[model samples]
Target: MSPLVLGPLVRCVEATSAAVWVETAAAARVEVRAGDATGEAATFAVHGHHYALVVVDGLPIGAATAYEVLVDGVPVWPEPGSPFPPPVLTTIDETEPLRLAFGSCRTSVPHDAAGNGSHGVDALRAYAMRMADLVPAEADPDGGAPRWPDLLLFLGDQVYADETTAEMRSFITARRDIDEPPWDELRDYEEYAELYRLAWSDPAIRWLLSTLPTAMIFDDHDIRDDWNTSLTWRRAMEATSWWHDRIVAGLASYWVHQHLGNLTATERALDPLWRRVLDHEGPEELDLSEAIDAFADRADQDPTSYRWSFVRDFGNQARLVVVDSRAARVLEPGRRSIIDDEEMAWLDEQVRGGFDHLLLGTSLPFLLASGLHHLEAFNEALAAGAWGDRAARFGERLRQGVDLEHWAAFQAGFAEVSRMVVETASGRRGPAPATVTFLSGDVHHSYVSEAQHSRARRRAGAPPLQSRIVQAVCSPIRNPLPRPVRFATAFLSYGVAGVLGRGVALLARAPRPILRWSYVRGPWYDNNLATLEVHDRDLRMWWARGVVDGDDHARPRLEQVADFSLDAPERSQRRRKRRAANRSGEAPSAFARRRSISST
Candidate 1:
């Protein structure tokens, strides 16, 4: 009921440092501080709606040390309570066993008051509650949720204007009637600001955001499902009377809600809008309300005018390429590209001279189920009517919101990135990482796969390729596929996709699929969480989900779903440990290979 307020994203955590990037509801002299029992330390000024990255250094290294941040010297947090939780300061630890929980495709909804049940817990929300319970009875107390994550990588769907929550509806209803053609959907920047408030402002969740060092990139749902997939999709939408307004609203809102938080201080300052923002003495930094809306309109009309994707490198070992896989799409005329030549060139150069591991954070998967992946590729070619003119109609139908053309459809870019990974590993391009892994979501299932160029590698005498490729997909933090749908997907992925892909590839005169891969991982569905680790010459990983007992809605337990190590030596060591335990007849059989989903 009272006016909602937010900003100055409290994100980006690493050992001895953290970055605070924020935008305000209004301007005020903002100051940020980080300290522990040693007393006040680390402070900076934050100009209104304009963004600033205040990095705190010299943090104590430990799992249990507590830190606090001050805004305008007011100590903006739960000294006690205002229903709004204040932020907390903690350092990120890269050593020891790592724990990270991430998933996307969430729609905000009203919380069930009685705490008996809610429309299936948001996985993030659930994790936050666990953290809350772990906190000591007072601020800066002795305990909290395992010091939280070093960094939380949010892949996509941060806010959904197209799909909203009940509380969000009331905010809309109070402002304007919902009878407009796109009324149910967001129209511009203002609506987007409010939607983000609803998404991040929940007390438990807000506290988590304040504490967790978060990184994010956008996917289609952040704007709309199947956004910018094809030229026809754009053309048809432009024909609509309300299309421009919708696009304007979507783009403007996105700049504030998602992109602002992700940019480095240097990057934001480089923007023309920020110059105007810095020029203003007023509290509001960049009043993108009108500017972003206009920018979105121009972009939709000329998709190549601006680039929305970026990359961030931490230290010299890892490179995170947050790609603009949705925007800058070349969906017109002869060819379609999710990324233009300039962007691909950037990735090529970045990945070519890499470190220990290369991470590409795209909303869509590069190696999808082979059959469906091929289906999308063939459908795209057929739609272009390279096969026959009549097939174009089917292509139009597919384009009218068909989710086609992932890496398989965009084969050229896929091949380039893959080759880069190989070259990097071979030391021809750069010092090879133990693995080149892709982290993604949107597929609604989680799995890991190993890539190879030939079946010869499958045989003993075959030579090993220079580099190896792996994909890790964790999706829809809360969306569980229906039972029947799951069965259908399994059958299709394993059986149907293979049979069907061969038929289509034969028609296209394509070379027999040179890529050979296997799902030596999982299809586990649980509104799940996972962690990825890259060490000197090995990689280790695991997945987890919340567990509950019969009808008890109070406190769900943490369940370890699956665990595996990529190093053969490590695997052999673990097996030996298990054997030793068995001989002693007192070994802990913690090998839980079973996994499933939990929902309302």
Candidate 2:
């Protein structure tokens, strides 16, 4: 067997440099060659697993070049008889429009009829096939072929450590006593390594990752369900013997597998841990098992010590700020927040307006469906003893039981971020962008919502809102909610839930949300992936799902689910006037032309 175990994933690409990551069967040097540029790095050991992140520089800006991977100086990638085209690394071009693909929540399973029947087809795989032109293109309902994405942003839940599949469970059973604490859920670094292998090993998806640059941040499932929902929850987990090992390993594995590649070469050079990797020159593989575990432990205990959130700029076109909403949370009672003070300050700095578009990627949606947002707010209030102590206990139970934790649940953090967004949109921070958009996943469903200052706040003489404040969510690139649960989710997230949530909030005396929003499209429950393209002053977005034809489950084709464009402010105002003149009560799906294909 080839020494390469998993990956060769292209990550964190800039105008002239890129990072390629790989896992090897044993300690060995990994090399990447693209055009005349070549980079190599020796494998680092973490709990017996070997990995390398080769930062290739000196490539011409805005150029595309096929790359080859070699392990121990022997060509190992573009595997013999591979069906996919040679993997290419394309550097960012400031002049070109930005195309980004994003989604979250995938479970690893066999790509066969049974797997598709159980979980749904892998939308990412279908997208990869479509990009590779392995699957014949059908007539797109929204005209023209889709442009290739400059980057793939995985919002969160790249692996479900808490929800193990049969394969993961089997591996667990073979390694340790399954009947022990934590059951079949992942326990340590080795389990995490295997889980990632299962998630990324599929041929088409593997090839796709090897070519396109990717950025990732973890959500709760990356550690465990509701990993740090509250101080009470944290205390309970700390009481358990297994939680320590589980957390240490989860975070340590994340650093090796996901977080390291999220950083730009410059950022990595500034990272002390990464500096250790670069400075090491010993003959044996530089073991990071103890050092990384210590770092993860410290990071979990004090999020202020290290930053997981990152910012990337697409020249003057766009700024992508991916926030770490899980580990950086302030979970103490009476002060619960999505992110602590230090993180919030960092985010405040990064969110300044200048680019044509401002994209904030959070694992949890910043603005959820109106009703659900209110519901979560009410829960937070009740849990904070807005009612009585008895009610607080009930509220805590309900919060954990139903997964009521989100940005809305952390009111202080939500309000602060809201202020920053409002300020940025109103041009107080800098030159306002055409749109301030939040890209998120974790809801298991997809939707689009537009936010505006509450009427009263607008009357309070807030600066004229210039940018379109919108939230677009795409989730479950593979894992779809069961049919029965989908009905309940829809009900709770739409009209009825909205009314109920507001009433509950009033009863609890919860602070009224500063902004009000309405759904522009969706609440669609499909295993899908979504993309955004910057078109001058306008931004276009669309969602697509994988559809298996006949029994060719392995060769699923991409089917469009929704397509819409957010128009420039002037165009949107005119369209609104036209709708009003026609006496249309229906909410317009987009600020511009829109198209959608109903779920089958």
- Highest TM-score among the candidates is held by which one? 2
| Candidate 2: clashing pairs of residues | none
- Write model 2 residue lDDT over 274-348, tens digit each, in one string: 998999987999998899999999999999999999999999999999999999999888788999999999999
State residue 201's C-alpha deviation in candidate 2, in Å.
0.5
Candidate 2, overall lDDT?
Answer: 0.90
Task: Give stretches of model 1 more than 4 Å off.
Answer: 1-4, 14-17, 21-25, 36-73, 82-87, 91-100, 111-119, 133-147, 282-286, 298-305, 399-402, 455-463, 510-514, 548-555, 568-600
lDDT values of the candidates?
0.61, 0.90
Give the per-residue Cα lDDT of candidate 2 at 412: 92
Q: At residue 137, give the lDDT of candidate 1.
A: 25
Off by over 4 Å in 2: 134-146, 574-600
